[model samples]
Target: MLKNSMSVEFMAISDNERFARSVAAAFVIGLDPTMEEISEIKTAVSEAVTNAIIHGYNDTGRGRIVMEGTIYEDSVEFRISDEGVGISDIRRAREPLYTGKPEDERSGMGFTIMETFMDSVEVESEKNKGTSIIMTKTVKQVGK
Candidate 1:
């Protein structure tokens, strides 16, 4: 059973989204993930980080976003967290096409994209504390 983990913290800014994606991809590379798996992971990471920067911190670029990853055998789990304004209504927030900031022309599909790319996604949030998105994916063995 291969096991490893990593954690990083950075300012919540739009520019860091790509950095987050790269970090996630690097963390999983040792698992021998397929190209599709890599793409999915990167996309999911992008969404989570973007949400932390945009929704959680309101694009203020003044909060910390902590991203962590753990590898267990052929599976990987990621947790992205931000100490910013948290979600008031998680249920409605998860609904498709629901944007808290409609004026920004947000598609409100951040959660949806994460759900689609990862095997499971769990959201933990408080009204004024912060938000954390926990996601997991199992690397499929393409060939024995």
Candidate 2:
């Protein structure tokens, strides 16, 4: 629960990915997010949620993803977390075109897309603890 910012918490489930994105989009829209910003935010959210479902949970459909959004005065932060197998190789996961499941047509572009969309993206995970993605984007004022 972030003070002075709007926050949303949602359970992580494969079927809830779209719902999470929609919630995030609605939150950003309340903050007067631009059309482009909304699109980017949605994409980033999708990537993070997908990663939580695929990589974190290994598509077992037995884990949960906790997503939170904080709207600050100058920026917005989105945190997506999951309790699952955790990331065994952070370096490899961050690498472009590196997919743990190549047969699924994953494209290995989750982190890449997140980085390109948001102003900053940070990942924290433990072998058995869980994984968390903190993504931030600075809002541009209209009449500055």
Local accuracy by lDDT, each model? 0.93, 0.84
Instruction: Report model 2's TM-score to 2 decimal places.
Output: 0.90
Off by more than 4 A, model 2: 1-12
Tell me which residue pairs clash in candidate 2. Answer: 12-65
Model 1 TM-score, 2 decimals: 0.96
lDDT of 2: 0.84
Q: Which ranges in model 1 have alpha carbons more than 4 Å from their true place?
A: none
Which candidate gets the maximum lDDT versus the true structure? 1
RMSD of each: 1.2, 2.2
Worst 10 residues of 2 by lDDT: 1-10
List model 2 lDDT by residue over 3-105, tens digit each: 3445455555667788888888888765677788888999999999999888888887777777778877767899999887788899889999999999999
Model 1 lDDT per residue over 1-144, tens place: 549999999999899999999999999988889999999999999999999999999999999999999999889999999988999999999998999999999999988999999999999998779999999999985643
